[model samples]
Target: MRTLSGDLIAHRLSQAPAGALSKRLYDVLQTAIQQGAIATGSRLPASRDLAQELCVSRNTVLAAYEQLQSEGYLQTRTGSGTYVCEQLPETAPQASLSPSTSSAPFNHIRLSRRGTRVLARSGAGAYQWGAFMPGVPDVSHMPHDIWRKIQLRLSRRMPVEALSYSNHGGCLQLQQALAEYLRVSRSLNCAPEQILITAGTHQALDLVAKMLCDPGEGAWIEEPGYWGFRNVLAVNGVELLPTPVDDEGMLLPDLASFSQLQRPPVLICVTPSHQYPLGSVMSLQRRQQLLALAKSAGSWVIEDDYDGEFRFGESPVPALQGLSADAPVIYLGTFSKTLYPGLRLSYMVMPKPLAARMKMAHSELYRGGNGLAQLTLAEFIREGHYAAHVRRMRQLYSRRRAALVKVISDSLGPAFLSQQGNAGLHLILSLPERIDDVALAAELEQKGVLTRPLSAYYIQGTQRRGLLLGYACVEEQNMAETFAPVLHCLQRRLSPA
Candidate 1:
């Protein structure tokens, strides 16, 4: 074992640039021990002598010694001096275990089958906010002051129970508030007991999948649908059946096409009010047919009413869940698109029969707890601030959407536009089938314009080629300038090919 004398320690301390003397000494000593310069079980100098040699205060040396001791790097004897630990905390476990128990190298490590699928099918993006980024709301205008005040007030006197894992479905106040809000705004018929708070649509989807589906079960989703729904079900081992969508929303898949499946679909995921990306409302006829199909097949219909509040001119479409007194639909709604994405608050109104079980499972699995935020939102809704904010954003988004449409039409002919629904935060820009939309989106991203390619949403079918362009967070006045580069790029791409 090497003897770490006061002079040797002072010399090591001098090699580092001056900063906090105690921290510098700690680092130098740690490096020395880790590198075996001061070998295991070596005795360290007395704190006072080391301080005198290094010209640091005695307290500084004591602090460094104490920190190292606390971290298991060094230990002090009752009468003797500080000595290096015989074994480091980091290496002791490995030293005790056999070679067979060693962890595999990074390249040799393997992910579970489910984990691999989850990673492979992820749809998340690097940048969430900027020009034409889809599915994001204008968080700048959210009533932050009001929300902050409510949060602060609640946090000051938050119950000990509120901080614990929420096993009672969710905060009752928010559930009751959502029950009333959904009834009035979206024509959703639900009781507070039937509503379960979730992290977001994905969690709600995950809950529905785990509860209603078994591994390898069949699920029907809209072709060119929200990638989130597909990825969630895919990771859970559900076989995806991409059903086609027209101007009237999700169409029934031909029974012959599903010959491989042993039985009917376990879940039918639909963005019924305003179809995601496409922005088509499911026709009344289609909605009835879907309900009938789900009932006969014993399948659950997941109605994702995301952004249904943002309809431009029309009264927002009634949610499919309210069509009947006992509809077999699970109504999913999110604050992400309306209030803001970071809120991470969304809900699902389960069928009367499934509500109790789903809620219990949700609490067990997710251990939901955001009482302060939940109560704050409850207060926001109760005070009518939520409604007022939605109305204001609807008007703002309408103007922005119009500005985006005009610029795109003026630069590239009106033929480029598709699914110009008078609702939702985004509009689809159609490209020729032959054009590589993923490649086009990548080029636009390079030019600082963010967009999602329509083709990527498809599971396996006739894929649509387009870009989903969002204008909600973007201001109307800056719309033309922000999208100018995209128009220039499209002009060149469309000219020859």
Candidate 2:
């Protein structure tokens, strides 16, 4: 009848890895019981005696004893003090692991079919900030002080509901604020109830894919389009139709072509305002044609109004959603490009008919919370700060774009500039067909010049060789110096061997 005495426990406790006193004591006693150091049904020293002997508090020993007893390592026998349980928590003693066995390489984990598809596609870059990182904004210019004040005000009157898991579309204040802003700014015809706030464009697209599309359905996306749209649909096992785009935007396929397909496309995603990478505004004729085609095909059109707020020349085009009263268009927009990416705030304005169902599905799939941020943004917009900020950023980006374009033209040539749109943060720098844009982009990155290869955006059709230079983040004063490395690299790549 071996007893777990204070001396033995103290030694084991010392041997136990550094941790809280109660935890160390508990681990030591548990190990002793498991290893049969103390025989089954053996008695333990009283808490007071053990505490005094080990120079610890009686409460610490009591806590360890209580935990051990709870875990079936020790049992309390009322007036009989503490005893080891005859039956251990584990079925049997853990086998000692050999050094080789412990150090062996872990077995490979096989991913699902969907997981494999997602892994095959990569859109995210290693670095998010710095010169020429496309689709990223100048976060330094963001009104942090104003945002902080708004957040602080909301915190003082924070409601219990703000902390709870929200299911309803989103913060009502934000939805209303966005509704008003969109109606006036973008000519979007949507009520506050039609909007569903999401955690960035990824979540918004994911939710749309899940709610509207199924495993085998067809989704038509613009060639040289946003890689994110392709990834989202790919994960859902949706068949992607990489429709080509011209100067006008996504070329709407003829009605006859739709009927010829084994699976007609149920959805079409387009960046009509300013086509991604290429930066071509979809023509008014093309926009009308697209809406008509969608109507005839009974397809949903997702209008991603990315960077629509930063047009340099002409007034911004009205969103595709407002083309018709009952247009089958889902308008998508985000504050990431407008404000800062960290906010993780984006919105989807659903067609009136789909609004209720989509909101219900959103709540079921992704519980919303971020009430404070949403509320602050609402106040920001309501107070006209949002508009003022956009106006300021537009002017700033315009200057930066002009400086970058001039540098490229002076260093390379005017012919290198491709589809330099009046809007958006980025412009395309077309390269010679022989130059591998991917390899060139890699070299440019090493030289501290970050640019996305235009060829990488194409899913199908003839690959165009170019680089998407995001000039919005770069300061106008530093544009010439910052682009020197890129120009040198391009000259080296383009020069004869």
- Candidate 1 per-residue lDDT over residues 1-497, each given as its tens digit: 22346766777776655678888888778777776778899888888777777777999999989988988999999899899999977852211222332447558778998888878878888889878999889889998998898888888998877788887688888999999999999898899999999999899999988888899899889887888888889888899988889889998744454444568888898998889878899999989888887776778889998889999978779999999888889988999988888989999998778888998999889999988889899989998999999999999999999999898888777988866789998899999887788888999998888998888887785467888899987899999999888778777887874
Candidate with top lDDT is 2
* Candidate 1 global TM-score: 0.80
Whole-model lDDT values for every prediction? 0.85, 0.86
TM-scores of the candidates are: 0.80, 0.81
Kindly give the stretch of ten consecutive residues in candidate 1 with the minimal lDDT sum.
92-101
**Pairs of residues clashing in candidate 2:** none
Clashes of each: 0, 0
Model 2 lDDT, full chain set: 0.86
